[model samples]
Target: MTDDQAYAGTAEGQGPVQIDEELARHLDNKRTELFEEFEIRDTFPDDVLIEAKNATQDPEADIEEELESGDRVDCRDLTTCTIDPVDAQDFDDAISIERLDDGRYHLWVHIADVTHYVHPGSEMWEEAVKRGNTVYLPAYTIHMLPPVLAETVCSLVPNEDRLAHTVEMKIDPETLSYEEIDIYKSVIHSDERLTYKQAEKRLDDETAELHDELTLVHELADKLHEQRKEDGSLVLNPARDRAHTIIEECMLKANKAVTHELQWVRGLEAMFRVHPQPTPQEWDKALREIQELDGVSIPGDAWDDPRKAVNATLEQAPGRQLNKIQWAVMKVMPRAKYMSDPFGGHHALNFEIYGHFTSPIRRLSDLVNHWIIYQNEGPEDHDLAELCDHASARQKAGETCERLYKQFLQEVGLDPHAVNARGLEVVEDEEDAELTEEEADTESAELDL
Candidate 1:
């Protein structure tokens, strides 16, 4: 999952929001202030940019040689497709699914093999380590890797045979458990790229392209979603649509599979996502707050598991009270961080062992994991714990930067959502200015998180 997905936030936007020169200046100044405060490096170094540019220039030739050398599996004919937000630029992941004759489901998750280009000792890799993760603001993005490389060679664009780290899983239909998991580098050709809206339409229309694939995956995803809740996993967004559910469940499964292999099977150290649970008192405090809400009541049985209680309450709570209930839970929830040890599992996702393997383009932890998985060894001479701490800290800084930037946008009479959906456009005159309070209010909706 991408950082935005992990955060349960959507960075998708429609068009550019036209603003006067004065407001644009204000936004720019606020961004500068936030970047300095967080120590976010917005610009790529000269050497890194040059390296990224050089890497993208000859990917096809290099990929052909690798394919010929038999180092990469060629799965180019797998009826694959990418689903992302409409405004998403570089597609980092794709999915392809099939049902075996034996009734088990076969799922293939293709994540762009960023390690193929940005490896250890490379300029891009060094820079990615420094950035930790991409800093996404309301109308701006500070990429972890240079866009020249990430958006080109690392992107799994349709019709292009791109290099990817594919996670192939044979899953049981009954328990939704993986019967077998295989991770390898491969060459894939994406047949199509569909936005979330398009994916939904495909599910609704029988005649739509990829209808069968989308429908099948959605069915599996729905089952996985319920199974997660049944297994005491915390689901903040009970009403997440089918498209988001498919991507989320699949990515979570893949991430869990990779980390499980690293820790249990390979017995190697890797970056694991660890989310500690709250204390009994903290849970009681949150539960009490939720119970006191006007129309929200946690199921009596679910009270034993705080995560389940929040899930049940959110599902039955009024739309207006949804945010309040979530905030109540979040207040007592500790921040999840990256760690070298997988002893403490992710509390929010309720996974025994979870780490990022999907979005290497934007996350340092995922990138490091990719390198480790490919090398079949831990990073030698590097302090994995220190990297984990740096990534966790940088992630917090990015979140803070985004929050403050949005607050600044609101203060400057611009809707951060509007600017996010529609990028900022500096107009020549005040009469041409676009944003209004009505527009902001109209765009306002409760954050799904």
Candidate 2:
């Protein structure tokens, strides 16, 4: 599910709500029930955790070895920065951009090289395949990889040299198309980390550290976003801010570049995202429903393309009706799935070829693609189609679990958005504090797999 769909009516940046012990227990029980119903694994196996701990033991020595062996490119000199949510734990991606003398743009997207640590024949790899992707609940997260590994070595923390899979693109100034693309392994040092709010501030303040770079990138990202809308791409979130636009456009460009290399240049099979278009009748039904909404109108010029029509309506629709408009479109839209062939293009993104590459830490498809690109070989013993099906199923299950969990929170008179933003604080009586601590310890021990 998209962010707008998952968090439709929730306000952002709310403070944490204090809950009594009784309510906290109720929330915990509901989460346990949902996990069982969806078959979501909440704990890592002992072997996987042990392997992750061992892998992160000597990071400095490993970097020196990799650099000395000439297997990785040296990019620590570049000015790189990561932009994520304020509460983000593990930073998986970062970006750096520059304006060239020829009026073109040079963009570098660096993603954590997760395949270097978790590959085939490893316990962590097996567990990651079983999980498929990270399951995110309100104020909670079930990581695909062990946190000891993902949060330490694989995280792109600031002021640290870390291994990365970098996509370097030289984009045309006029067309916003890639003039040159290069994908390679590198070691990078992030100069700083900025939250989404901080990034917006940088864009407004000319005296900020990364003000120039952010300004240049936002210009390119805005143009790219406009180009996507013009080419019939469906954008559900019309109010997305400049920080989000910069990140979204850059990641889409990098993912497209990697998949284009895999299919057209290398002639190999990888997990491609294929979103089937809704039937013509279904599109008509959605349009009719949207038109009936008060104060909403679809321009006549965009009627030929349903995606464009929705985009146009959303831009002009009232803020209160945004959720309804999105639901109208989503009800008729087909769920996108992964496939070994890139023949069926993604209907929503309106890309001829698209796949995952920028988020290897949480997604199985991106992790598999990283391995394939690095080794230049497809999985010989594995069924690619089966993997694709498993990923799609698990993703659906995760989404369902999250939806149910959020509904339960609302039923209990707690704001899901508030809990998600500021987290929950369990308030206990003075006499029950010790007992509560004991019970929590017991529960922690039970969860340590």
Question: How much does candidate 1 score in TM-score?
Answer: 0.94
Candidate 2, residues 1-449: lDDT per residue as tens digits?
43212222322544355777888788889889998999999998899999998888988788888999999999998889988776676888999999999999999999999988999889998899899999888788999899976777989988888999999999999999899999999999998888787788889988888899999999999999999999988888888889988988999999999998999899988888888989999999999999999999999998999999999998998977777888888899888898988887888899987898988888999999999898887655668888889998998999899989977877776666556656776767633321111111010000000
Count of clashing residue pairs in every prediction: 5, 0
Cα deviation of 32, candidate 1, in Å:
1.0
Model 1 stretches astray by more than 4 angstroms: 1-15, 438-449
- lDDT of all the models against the reference? 0.84, 0.84
- Give the Å shift of residue 171 in candidate 2: 0.3
lDDT string for model 1 (1-449, tens) is: 63213312333433467899888888888888888999999899899989888878888898998899998999998999988866566788999999999989899999999988888888988899999998878668898989876677788888889999999999999999999999999999999887787688789989877899999998898998899889988887778789988998888888888988899999988889898989999999999999999987888988888888888888898988887888888898888889999888888878887888899988999999999998987666579999999999999999999988887777777787667656677999999888744344322122211
Clashing pairs in model 1, backbone N/Cα/C closer than 3 A: 13-421, 14-421, 15-422, 16-423, 17-423
Task: Please give each candidate's TM-score.
Answer: 0.94, 0.92
Candidate with the greatest TM-score versus the true structure: 1
